[model samples]
Target: MYDVSNPHYMGDHTGTRKFRRVLLKLSGEALREPGSTDNISPPIVEDIAAQIKAAHQTGLEIAVVVGGGNFWRGVSASNKGMERATADYMGMLATVMNSLALQSMLEAMDVPTRVQSAIEMKNVAEPFIRRVATRHLELGRVVIFAAGTGNPFFSTDTTAALRASEVGADCVFKATKVDGIYCSDPNKNPDAVRFDTISFHDCLTKQLKVMDATAFSLCMENNMPIIVFSMNEPDNIRRALVGESMGTLVNASGKDA
Candidate 1:
């Protein structure tokens, strides 16, 4: 068993070889086509799966944590009068749906896949077990972590960091709408500067919102690196897997290699 808690466990972060294992964090919006009423788009999922398939072909162990913002946002629903816990639970169900869709597409592409849900639904997905998930990855099976840590008030971003730390992943790859982290919201600030690399301490001190506070804290505490990059870029997933340096990397040191 890979002991992530061991003090001397220096993950495969040498950048001397291809990443041994990584956790990809994808938002639910990635599955929905913009300007379309549909909540889930097959073509978008297929595109994402194709890139992942190409990367998996390289023998890199891949695990994914998918968010549920497309179908539901717990905080948004709660603010509209629904109970917070109930709204969060509904959000968890949404992630399960997205996970199943991605799994179907990856399997259709002949890539072995598994969906592990934190909130178990026996007929559809296996209950999340750390050892089992690690074993699946070791066997070269792609594992999609769904249901957001089986608890309310925890964002999927936090789940990504937590899972990466638990599984001894080399880094957390955040597939987002933006190309990388910027000094400000690039859309709003035309002059916002993008950093090739930034330190976790700087990210906090500067209030760069690469992720939620809890997620950032978790990654920092675990010394897990995060790569923030755009999912819309063609073959970006594969590029990231092979360490082609396309996005902003957040780590202990603020320097890019």
Candidate 2:
């Protein structure tokens, strides 16, 4: 169990009210280091669990949605003649694997975690239920949503947005390798400028690739702010939760004002 009595609580002084609840979206690749064949690296899992534990200790309710790209991508495979439904099912299974690994890591750190899947896999996780998930959060257990909405065509990003809306999360945090949204591909364009904040309309107009069109639209329509930031940096997850102003904040308004 995470010791809630620890004195290392980092405070946020940005005057922005802290989010009461948040949805964190993790990509499958984040469970491993770059260019590695391993599906679940022990160090990466430990690091993530530690960050999540810290944030949870601060009294913010959290829910997670993980992608299955590290093991497979149903849509990508379907383009090569694989049956779309079958490929999607495989992708859902992959997400379950990632969710289990994450749950184990968080539990090892005493963070109290639960895994819920869209498709019923009674042997592994509970079938996703909105009320049950809300109860878990209220009771201080981290809820990890898996299986991608139990649908074939939708991506996990869409699932994250949908779940955030369903659970009334105040914001969605997208953990990426990059620190923030840039004007262009930061890797190729060294001079790409990073935005401290951005509007949903501007992101769509500029064709920003922070998230898919479907996910972005859902969040926009519902007035949910999404933050994109680097998970590779130590303590970034906790910092973001505390309103550190380290990521690109996407909201409905044209500006933060």
Candidate 3:
């Protein structure tokens, strides 16, 4: 149940609004420029920070879960003969780097932010504490969750789901290259159909790759809504925060396929 009296409450329980607080899931590749040698492009991160700043100005509580694919991919490394646990730990550290980069840019714009790493790194960030993270959101500080559950086999997607549920966020906004969920991969299938809204059960039954199985399962179990949209479009993050419908909605109330 949502408490209307909570200072962090941005919407009412009567369905007049949605998404008071949300978790944003971003891929490390989002910060990288295509065909560039650099792992992270400053210009791209700046753009993303600017968008986030714009949204934060609207008084939305934002938490971010970013992946570490740009610097390292544990699964890929493990596939290439590295130990899975070691590679994943390194991958977690890579997320911290991205988190710090985003935090620096946001602070430069005067947006209060905090990075909480699942893996304790006292020199750089606060350890992941659910209450502290939620308090940061209530205080209008953007919280960036790094380190992917601090585990070897989990993903940042699962982190988003877990943190969103733990913090009682309204939804999880998944930023991706595609506009929304489709019947098939739009890149490979020209005849793919996009759904404006789809039920969690439908996504599962159809085997749509909205997120990793663990992440999707977590959301489904928690009744957490997810919005999947393209982050490539300018001001899309701001638009999404302000409740402009531009992506597919995956939730319990969605129509069954």
Candidate 4:
């Protein structure tokens, strides 16, 4: 069990409590360190599990959407002449693998978890059912959604947005390598400006690449807010959940007419 004595307990009022329930979106690359092959590193998985456990202990309902970029990317495979649909299906399977690995880590920490796939894989996980997922959340099970909307050409970002809306999540936390959204690629341009808050419309007009067009459109249409933050920082996940002002907040409130 994690030492609750640490100051990072989830519900602490020192941090803002922006939302009641949240959907966390993680990329497949997050499972492994950069330049490593596709697979979940034990340390990384455990670290993420610990963070989720902390948030779970705070009595917040959490759900996750994981991507499959490490194992497969339909766009890249299609470039190699593989059929788009076939490549996408392969990507979906990769996400299932990631989901199972995450589930194992979360369960090891004694956090109850359920894996729900957009495509049916009864032997491995439950099919994507909105009510079932909601019930799982109500029961305090951390639900991990996999398979990227069960369709071709749609990115996992879209899946996260859709799942967040369906589960009635107050916001979607997009865990990324960077601390927040910037005016330019932070790595490429050291002087790039980071936005504490940005409107979805401005992000779209600026082509900020916070998320793909489809996902951004879905969130904008639904008025769902998304918080982009760094996953590398140990307590960042808990911080974001508790509404600490740590990353970029993108929503309708920040949107410009």
Best candidate according to TM-score: 1
lDDT of each: 0.88, 0.86, 0.86, 0.85
Candidate 2 lDDT over 80-184, as tens digits, reads 999999999999999999999999999998899999999999999999999999999999999999999999889998999999988888888999989989999
Model 3 Cα shift for residue 189 (angstroms): 0.6
Cα lDDT tens digits, model 3, 87-159, are 9999999999999999999999999999999999899999999999989999999999999899999988999
lDDT of 4 at 196: 75
Q: Show where candidate 1 strays beyond 4 Å.
A: 1-17
Global fold similarity of model 3 (TM-score): 0.92
- What does each candidate score in C-alpha RMSD? 3.8, 5.5, 3.7, 5.7
TM-scores, all candidates, are 0.93, 0.92, 0.92, 0.91
Error of 4 at 9 (Å): 19
Clashing pairs in 1: none
lDDT of 4: 0.85
Which window of 10 residues has the lowest lDDT sum in candidate 1?
1-10
